[model samples]
Target chain A: VGPGDDAAVLSTGADEQLVVTTDVLIEGTHFPSGSRSDLIGYRAIAVNLSDIAAMGAEPRFLTVALTLDQIDDEWVKGFAKGIAFCASKYGVKIVGGNIARGALSLAVTAIGVVPTGQCLLRSTARIDDDIYVTGTIGAASAAVKDGVKVPPLELNELWSRRVDDMSCRYFMPLPRVQMGVALRGLASAAIDISDGLMADLGHLTRSSGVGAEIELDRVPVWKSMDAEIAIEASDDYELLFTAPAKEAERIAEMAVRIGTDITCIGKVTAGESVAVNGEVGRIDSPKGYRHF
Target chain B: VGPGDDAAVLSTGADEQLVVTTDVLIEGTHFPSGSRSDLIGYRAIAVNLSDIAAMGAEPRFLTVALTLDQIDDEWVKGFAKGIAFCASKYGVKIVGGNIARGALSLAVTAIGVVPTGQCLLRSTARIDDDIYVTGTIGAASAAVKDGVKVPPLELNELWSRRVDDMSCRYFMPLPRVQMGVALRGLASAAIDISDGLMADLGHLTRSSGVGAEIELDRVPVWKSMDAEIAIEASDDYELLFTAPAKEAERIAEMAVRIGTDITCIGKVTAGESVAVNGEVGRIDSPKGYRHF
Candidate 1:
């Protein structure tokens, strides 16, 4: 049974060994208990997996940290079900974890891998690399903002639906798994859009030691939201990536192969600071969810 | 330089694979902020790592979950120093982690391993196993109690030193790495004593589908605290384990090899329930640390 062993041995047919990351979601900060137990559990692991995905790594295993106040079999069962569902969907395994007591929170550490030296990163972006993002953005923030303000009863079903962006992306944000895998050899640098595009791209530029000229006209926003609203709201969880200008067409082809949307937003420059249109803007020094 | 890559690259030789475990430590329950930051970091990783050591594993890489109200570089530095000291002490690598905003807490997910199928567990005890433990217990709890009470005697370093049990184990509870490795083939069932010995033994017996006879006379207590005070106090982080009755001498020799103290406290039987004498006594369940 391999019981009492130092480590749980997990074998992967792939060459590159493992990808690891951890994120702590607190009780009052990440979300209110308003989220279903199932989604909460799913998102707990999903967020960490997304970090792995952003590296273009295939998630194979996760170790979760859960702090609890009181133990309830049923509640634990629900949480486990959510975790199991995510694992099954991603072809990952729940190898091991610690269950301790405290204020309710989740700390998930996900590990995965790609070729030994072939993972994507923001540091690899060249000065002229084109910046692109995959799928819709800012829908989650809109969901949060609109979900709280219930619409009037006089509205029609369509109008009622319009009251909130129940795009299912906020409660259960999709990790760009296929897109990330496809970009393994295509994109030079990439990150998930946990914050706004401007903010995350700022991270990309800072890490890569380059600036970017992001034409607002070329930047993509959730078609449903007002352009200004989408620009400021974050929590998109989409893929914000940088690829060599020469490979932009190939990167687009990759997104097509993965059945994901791709939008060209900006191009890398030789200096520091992200410029919106032609002007050096605050986009270069992007600010995200500040929880001080 | 696999910066921002989809997956992080880690290299391990054949002799030493990766040992992995994740644990969540919360505030108010695990520690108060006034609790020494260095010790909090030390114990957060130490308690989680005790599981790995109990399995006879070497600690390698760690992914930390840092939740904070404000980003105090000093606190971060202290916490990092604590982790770095232990990681360096155990030859562990700190590769990557995420910093999130929330209540001050830590969830350290550590990875280390020994050979395949060599990890220890609580389900391996046999019918006639002689139970053994490494080191004095209840020191951590005593330390915790001492940490809260600020002694009123100024310029009394001797008295403060004499009274601070928390100063000993509370901040620096030892993980029984040597004893765990020594029990590879000698001990049958094993687990680190997170809960008190009696309570944790209850888990051991339950896991093995057996009962145990733990003589109150044989249970190990810290020199600084009386047996009565230590019984209910936990945070010992010692290895409470069982081996074949025939291997008692070998067990002692192995304990010597590990440079840790050992005591034969009890034996395993073919029934259910854990007890101090011969009956299932009230161990008080340690305020229920498992919550869902």
Candidate 2:
């Protein structure tokens, strides 16, 4: 039974566990004026997919709840196409959802599956475990800061290309699902960097009942970004995970196989505070986006 | 194992099938101005629960994605309390969700479980099956229509009581989970009556590749509601189902056991059109809420 049915049924293997997460993107807030509807739909699903990946689960299904203030045929068509494109790339099926009238916004609840006892948890990071972050950070945040502005039509080709690249980064974030699934058995604890790299690391340390020491010099930040800004900029949907020191080589090998850079920039320690560069400086959100 | 993790994990029994559905409630649309924040939270989850019940599934878990334009401490507290209360009532847990800054809206994805291969599907109604509806329709629709107007403080006691009752019905819907689960093996096809009685019946007939003849005189309507109005009013949140004529007695018994009324108002036939009161009348929406 499909759309006409009141609910969708999924048959799960006895030993498999279902992983669920949800995220929302709003028009005026998340996607400012002149934003593409396609990117809005894509980002809405990507953020939730990042959460599922953080748990080292295989993406399986999704339900999208969309609300629109006004019905524009073109906009709706573009949004649906974007959703279908992103869902196909992630191999997730659109199961069930509701559409309603309101401010333009989308909420996606993504379901994933993992073998029992194989889910990576944020509360399992052990002390002395090396903390690693995958891919470069701060590019998406920088893009969002600079991409929304409309440039002059007569702008130089080089500048136009630069703007286009930045906008693309801002619009489509690559959820590191492959690397997350690969770290299933190796990672002690993991969290996605949706709330800035350092803030999410803080969340992991708090959940694990420990602290972390981050080396600013070793952090992989986007070019021209300040280390401090990179640590506070949200929208880097990369994985930050903790693993034992002995698995560093295995982690590197997995990253190589996945074709993404993974850097060990910190270590878990005793206590319940996060220290950046040997100082007791906590990750602060000076200009970062806060969900609530 | 729960909130602190990236996603929630649900362990299903070997033979259990998972049923999923999602719904959204927007402030300006679903609840108009002057609606209570607590009820907003309650209805957000209740509507999704109704979807699960429509499929004869036991409600299990939910993920709520909330976006708010502005932060109000009291509103947020009441909303959370309402969610907690509703979750407790349905024995469903708040598993995973996201909170963001945007238009005030809530999207909840509910997960339920049913026995494998036994889900009451919408496309399974056989020709000549008697069609039935659970509970009175039009109360919720009427309440939403009338309750949005602010009542004068000097109103009489009797009128105040009437308004209060109507508004309560609009705010709090009782999902017929018990009746749905009980009708699992008895009902050939089932659908929730959220998009009005006639519209939903049309959906059922289309999916089943059959037609229905509804006797308007036999349809149950709320006090003071016209038969036509009741059939076209949205937000009834009741169940419309089909079963063989021989099972009418059993359906009535189940309804009595669940403390709700079940009315046999129609019958399925081999055709492709819905006829009301022996007339080929299709339900048309004049001012009904449309999502798209």
Candidate 3:
């Protein structure tokens, strides 16, 4: 009976509380209409969860803002299924979501609470840290190119084997949940690869007040990707991380224990710059999703 | 530490939830750039609170999704101030929000959890119940013609005193929180004034699987407004509710106690149609806020 009361009282008893972040996925900009509803829903939650993962926090809940062209019942059903599948996979719950008509868009606000001071941020990288990335990169970029049949939006056979590749990476970038938790205290700084490797790494350096020298030769590339494609391809939902070189073996060990791959790509430098050793002519500029 | 983990978790604690509702506000359709940022923000939250009131739920925590054309810090700040004022006025907290670039729309998913089963909804109305409305209706519609002055986007007295009736209703609507809370157990079916009296009442009727015969003569009309303006006019944030005649009197008392005014609009009838007698025709043929 307190709908219009003076104030509202919310109950949340966690002391080390609230991992909050927002991400927007728009039509034409993020995904096209012909895209699978499952992929759309999966990525919607996955990207937001990546933000939570970057904080080294376990994502437990999500609030979805879905703006639609019209309530395509079948599409909504598939979208909901994708969201639920992701939630079930992560053990997260969709406590709330809004349904309204607008340009096809979805904005998700994810919240999680971790133990106090345990949350990781991009600002923790230090000079001389070994730069590493989880899983493969550039496959997503290549999938967008000619002759690359990116599994029919749905998880078909083509999508299964290379599910970890960049194209699938675009739809379902597995947030490094296991490695994130395992590398919590070990890794110096971490970020999910949404933008290009150079770009997201730049964020880590900028936030940590340091520069990085990424060794193009040391970068982990996939069998399908060539040298040039590896340099500029983006949407690799892997973790591009910086840790002390001394922890290189440990990082690899942790990745093994977590059942994921870790590859050393470069090292954190003392100065201010993200230099690609030989990739894409040393990406001196910031190439990422700019919200303007 | 599960960056790529399944999901992040936020605690809702042991408090009984109060209010929960989802409303999407679109750009170009809802408000223009010429509209004041303060009013936009205020109306955004206010309209949402109106939903909470309809459910007879307390206004508490809010989550905002700002899909922008460009990231305008000043515009956002002004918009936030407007919503912040409403939240502060009602003691609701701005828990979190997301910012992303889109075609320019905003969606707010607000939550207020009260004692379970105490919330009011449109499905609870019964026949022979009294119909009531909170505050004046159609002022917002007339403001379109009268050029309703609104509260200043910034601190300007000229805009403050010179009221734009239509704009105020369109921009800022008072969700009758106190009244809504008071009518909790008494009122049957309830809804906030968004689409217009006739239209919203239809939702309540349809939900309750009943019909209504609103007394056209009994409908509340502003002194400056005639029946013509009243029928089609929208954006009145008043609460239209149905209840037993005796309990309807209590709703009236609650409105008075809150220092606001309300009127007995109509009655719940048998069969599924909303009419305003011969003097007034059916309003809202297109309905409210149909986005493509």
- Highest-lDDT candidate: 2
Evaluate candidate 3 and give its CAPRI docking class based on DockQ.
Answer: acceptable
Candidate 2 Cα outliers beyond 4 Å, as residue runs: A148-165, A278-292, B148-164, B278-292
Q: Which candidate, 2 or 3, has the higher lDDT?
A: 2
Clashing pairs in 2: none
Per-residue CA lDDT of candidate 1, range A205-283, in tens?
7888888877766656666565545655676778888887888788777777778888988888998767776233334
C-alpha-based local distance difference test score of model 2? 0.80
lDDT for position A188 in model 2 = 96
Q: What lDDT score is found at residue B115 in candidate 2?
A: 95
Q: What's each prediction's clash count? A: 22, 0, 40
TM-score of every candidate relative to the true structure = 0.86, 0.89, 0.75
Task: Give the candidate order by descending lDDT.
Answer: 2, 1, 3
Strongest candidate by TM-score: 2
- Candidate 3 has an lDDT of 0.69
Which order, best to worst by TM-score? 2, 1, 3
Provide per-model DockQ scores: 0.44, 0.71, 0.25
